[model samples]
Target: MKLFVKDLTVIDSSVLDYSRGIIGQSWLVDIVLHGDLNEQSMILDFGIVKKLIKSTVDELVDHKLIVPAHAKFCDVMSDGAFTYVDAWREHGESIHLACPDQAFALIPTEQITLASLETYLTEQLMLRLPNNVKQLDVKLREEKIDGAEYCYSHGLRKHLGNCQRIAHGHRSTIEILRNDERDSALELSWAERWKDIYLAEHCDMVSGSELSLSRAGMAALTPEHYCFKYQAPQGEFQLAIGKSIVEIMPTETTVENIAQYIADTLAKDCSDALTVFAYEGVGKGAIASA
Candidate 1:
C-alpha cells in the first residue's frame, strides 16, 4: 500500500518559542504509511516503512530534535517542511526511498521559512500524478560511522573534560523486510485493549505457556509499564519492562487468564498500577492502597 500524508504543514505561524522547544513549532497529524512487501507481494510483518515514517516524524517533531542549527533563520518565517530520513545499513540487502521529484529541495537551516516549505510540500504531495511531487522519504543514502568526540583531562586531581576514545554510532540504512515482533507491535498499538497475535503464532514456544496471555497483555497493566519482548531478523531487544506492577491473585485463575484479568481488574480497581517492573525481569506486586 502507498502512504498518504493529509497535510504537510502546520498552519500557525506565530506560536514558535524556545520555551516549548522546536517541536512546539511542528504540526501534529495522523500518518499512514506502508510496510515493506515480500516476494508474494504481501506486506511484510516488519512494519519497516511504517516505523520509518513515524520515527522520521518523531525525529523531526519530538525530543530535543527541534533545535535548528541555524538560529538566524528562526525568524522571518511563516512555513517550512521538515523531512526525516529513516536510515538503516547492511552489506547488500536494503530498502530505500527517494525524492518523488527534485522540485522540492532542502534549504540550509538558515533559509527554512517555518511553514512555507512545509505548506508547499503538503499541497504538492496531494496533487495527483506526480505534478506537485513534494513527497519526501526517510531512507538511508550512505555508509559511514557516526561522529566521535575528543575529551581532555586535568592533572593531580585528574578531572575530566575532553574526549579520548573513538565512538561509532549511526542509524540503520536498510528497510525492514519482515519482522514478526514489530508486526505484532504496531498492530496492537492501533487496537483498543488488544490486537490479534499473528506474532505469537505456532512457533518455537513451550507447550505450557499461556499463548492467550497476549504480550499485549501488558496493556491491561499499563501503557507506561515497560513490558515487551521483541525479536528481529538481525538483532533484537525489549525496553521499559521494568517499573510495573499488576495486582491480581492468580490462585483462582489459570496463568493463561491471570495477567490479562489482573490488568483488566487493575484498570477498574486501582488508581495506580498494582504491580511494578522496576527493571528487566525484576517485578513487584501488591502495592499498598493510598
Candidate 2:
C-alpha cells in the first residue's frame, strides 16, 4: 500500500554554493510512504503524517542553513554546541557563519540541490519511521511562481525560535500596487534588486576584528565583505558575506518592516499611494501602504 501527502511543508533555508556563495531558498515538500496496512487497514494516519513527518522535516532543515559538507570549498566544524562554516566561492569570495548546532543541516553531499536534499531527507526520515514502512519517497520542489520572485537570506535576532539563526533565508515573491492598481514593472524591479541578496540591519554590522569566528573564518575575509554578529537567546551568531550581495537596512528586516520600507521608498517618488506586499516565504507575508 502507498500513502502520499502533497504540500507536506515548506523549508526556508540558506545553502552554501561553490559559485554563488550563500543562496537563500525555499522548497515545498511532498512525501510518499510504501508500507503494508496496519491493524486499522491504513498505511499511516493522516494526523500522524501531518504531525510526525512535518515536524521532523521542520526540525531538520527549516529556518536553518544547509551546508554541503562534502563540497570542496566548504569546511565545517563543531565545538560541542555550535557549528562553524567556511564556504568559499569559486572566485575567492567566501561566506562564514557560526551558530548553534541546531541552526544547520550538514548534508553529506557535494552540492545542495533538490535531488541531493531529497535523498538526504529520505534517508533521515526512514530511520524514524515505523517498522511496517518498507520505503519512503521524498520530493523537494520550488513553488511555481508566475511572477517576480527573489531569494534572500536574513536573521531575526529578536525571534525566540529557529528564525534567530543568522544565515537562514527564504525565496519570496513581491507584489506592488500603485494607487491600488497592480504594478508588474515595479515588482520586477524590486525582484532584480534583491536577487540572491542578504537583507541585514545596520545595527548588526560589526568590524571583522569584533566577529566571533574561527581562525580560518577570519583568514577568509577580504575588503569586499561585510561582517555581522549578534547574541540572541539561542547563542552567539556571526556571518561574513561579500558586500555586493547584501542590503543593509536602517531598521529590522522583518517582513512587516520590509513592506513598510518598500512602500515608503516608493512613496517618495510619486504623489500616488503605494502598497507593498513583502513575503517572507510561501503563502504568508505582510502588507503596508503609504
Candidate 3:
C-alpha cells in the first residue's frame, strides 16, 4: 500500500548564498510512504499522516534558518540558547547572523540544497514511521511563475508565533491597479527591487553605523554592510548584511505594511486611487489602497 500527501506547505528560512544572504523560501512539500495495510484496513490514516507530517516539518524547520555547517565560507557557533553564523562571500564580503537556538537548523551538508534537505528529512521521517513502512519519499518544490515575481526572506521578531524566528521568506507575485487598470510596469519594478532581497524594519537597523568598506576599495564586489538587532517574543535576534540587498520599511515587514507602502507611494505619483495586492506567498496576502 502506498500513502501520499501532496502540497504540504512550509517556509524555508535559510541563507543559501552570499549574494542572496538570507532567503525565506516557500516550499511545497510532497510525501509518500510505502507500507502494508494495518488492522484499520488502511495504509495510514490521512488525518494522522497530515497531522504528524505537518507538525514534524513545522517543528523542525518552518521558520528557522537552515545553515550548511560544512560550507567553506560558513562558520557557525552555538551556546545552547543561541547560534551565531559568519558567512563570507567569494570576494571577501560577509553576512553575520545571531539568533536563538530555535531560529536555526545546523545541517551537516557541505551546502544547503533541496537534495540534501530531503535526505535529512527522510532520515527523520523514517524513524517516526511504523515498522511496516518500508520506503519514505519526500519532495520539496518552490512555486514558479512565468510573470514577475520576487524571492525574499525576512524575520519578524515582534511576531508572537512561529514568525518570530529570525528567518523565513516567500516567492510572491504582486499586482498593482492604477485607476482599476492593471499596471505591469509598476508590478515589475517592485518585483525587481525585491528580487533575492531581505526586507527589514528601519527600527531594527543600527543607528549611524558606517560598516561598509571604503569607496576606494572594490565597491562593486564589496557591498556596504549594515547591522540590526531586536528582541522578539522568542528571544534576541541579530542580523548583519550588505546594505544594498536590504529593503527597509518604515513599518514592520508584514504583507499589510508592504501593501500600504506601495499604495501610498503610488498615490504620490498620481491623483487616481491605487490598489496594491501584496502577496506573502501563494494564494494569500493583504490588499490595501490609497
Judging by lDDT against the true structure, name the best candidate. 2
Q: Put the candidates in lDDT order, highest first.
A: 2, 3, 1
Q: Which pairs of residues collide in candidate 3?
A: 24-169
lDDT of each: 0.24, 0.90, 0.77
Per-candidate TM equals 0.21, 0.97, 0.90
Q: Which stretches of candidate 3 lie over 4 Å from their true place?
A: 207-223
2 against 3, candidate with superior TM-score: 2
User: What TM-score does candidate 3 get on C-alpha atoms?
Assistant: 0.90
Model 2 over residues 1-290: C-alpha lDDT tens digits?
89999999999999888877678898999999999999999888999988998899998899989999998898899999888899878887788888889889999998888999999889999988888899999999888888999999999999998889888899999999998898999999999999989989999999998887778999878788899999999988999999988999899889999899888888888788888999888988999999
TM-score of 1: 0.21
Q: How displaced is residue 230 in candidate 1, in Å?
A: 34
Q: What would the per-residue lDDT of candidate 1 be over residues 1-290, giving only the tens digit for each residue?
A: 64554432221111112322111122333333344444656442235434544444433332112223244323222122212211111221111111111111333343335444444333433342122223343221122312211111000111121100000011111110112112222222222222110111112122212212223332233333322222332122121211211111323222223334434444463454333111100121122111
What is the Å distance of residue 163 in model 3 from its true position?
1.0
Span of 10 residues, lowest total lDDT, candidate 2:
15-24
Question: Which numbered prediction scores highest in TM-score against the true structure?
Answer: 2
